[model samples]
Target: MDKTPLTDPALAQLFTQARTYNSWSDRPVDDATVRQLYALVSAGPTTANSHPGRFVFIRSAAARARLRPHLSAGNVEKTMAAPCCVIVAYDTRFHEFMPQLFPSRDFSATFAGKDAVIADTAMRSSTLAGAYLILAARALGLDAGPMSGFDKDTLEAEFFPDGRWKANFLCNIGYGTDDQLFPRNPRLAFEQACLDL
Candidate 1:
């Protein structure tokens, strides 16, 4: 595949002009678009291709009601107003799929008895997938508001009662409104945030 820089508009859409929205328009994200978003997100690389992320897209009134009690006070209104709220989660038994994901060799045993390694890998990779989700949503002309302000324990119990998947974060998705937006914040310059090594 030939690698080329993305067009300026694409860059702006995915990063420069993209904002974490707080208000959503009445427009809804259709199921087909959500499916496309996942197809893009799943293609992103993960540690040993562990691919641990599991998403629960809350689009119904009943699902949102179930999630409402778990959100922080500040996040409640915007989240409930959005057309969709995605529960970005990680699978605890992610390594079980290693044989299929990393078929060149047996990598599942590396995480079999090591609880710490399993948790760490799953969390890290799932978070990467969450970031991919945001980018994918933007690429598809959807808006995103990713937040961590929620009751983790209660949310996990409420959404993942089986103890298999754990919530990583929540992201509200839809057509967003700038009515509730604040001025764009500054980001660290390369010199301030990176090292030449």
Candidate 2:
């Protein structure tokens, strides 16, 4: 298998040049693209293949209106204006799927009666899946604005009525413009962020 590196342009498009957008154009993100994004992102690996992540794409004015009251004041306009806003959540009963995801053995027993273990995997693995979604969206020529400025409890009550799933974070997706971007923030060097140990 070839281990060829990505081209500079591709790297820039997905990482170096990617920005958390606050403003988007009038063009909308079609449903087909959203489904394609999910298919591409679902291939990403997760702990125990828990695959707890679930998403609610708020593309309609009525749904966005329902989501508005849960958001922080600062996040209101940006979220409502984006072509699509996603409610990234996790399933508390994720272990139920373990027999299918990790079918080599019966792993569901590991979390059968453990609520804490279930919660931990739900949050951690869902977050990883959310990251995969963001990257997949970028690769498909879209921008993602991942944020956490919302009331999780309120969102869950509004979106997840059965209490089966819980909100982790919110992300607005679209083709962004430089108009709302603040200056690029500084990043830590590898020496500052990592340790050999």
Computed on alpha carbons, the lDDT of every model, listed in order, comes to: 0.96, 0.92
Off by over 4 Å in 2: none
What lDDT does candidate 1 reach at residue 59? 96
Q: Which pairs clash inside model 1?
A: none
Per-residue lDDT, model 1, residue 190, is 100
Q: Each model's TM-score?
A: 0.98, 0.97
Q: Per-residue lDDT for 126 in model 1?
A: 97
lDDT at 81, model 2: 91
Error of 1 at 120 (Å): 0.8
- TM-score of candidate 2 against the unseen true structure: 0.97
1-197: candidate 2 lDDT, tens digit per residue = 98999999999989998889999987899989999989987899988788999999999999999999999999999999998999999999988888888889898678989999889989999999899989999999999999999998888999999999999999999989888998889999999999998
Best by lDDT: 1
lDDT of candidate 1 over 49-140, digit per residue (tens) = 88999999999999999999999999999999999999999999999999899989898579989999999999999999999999999999
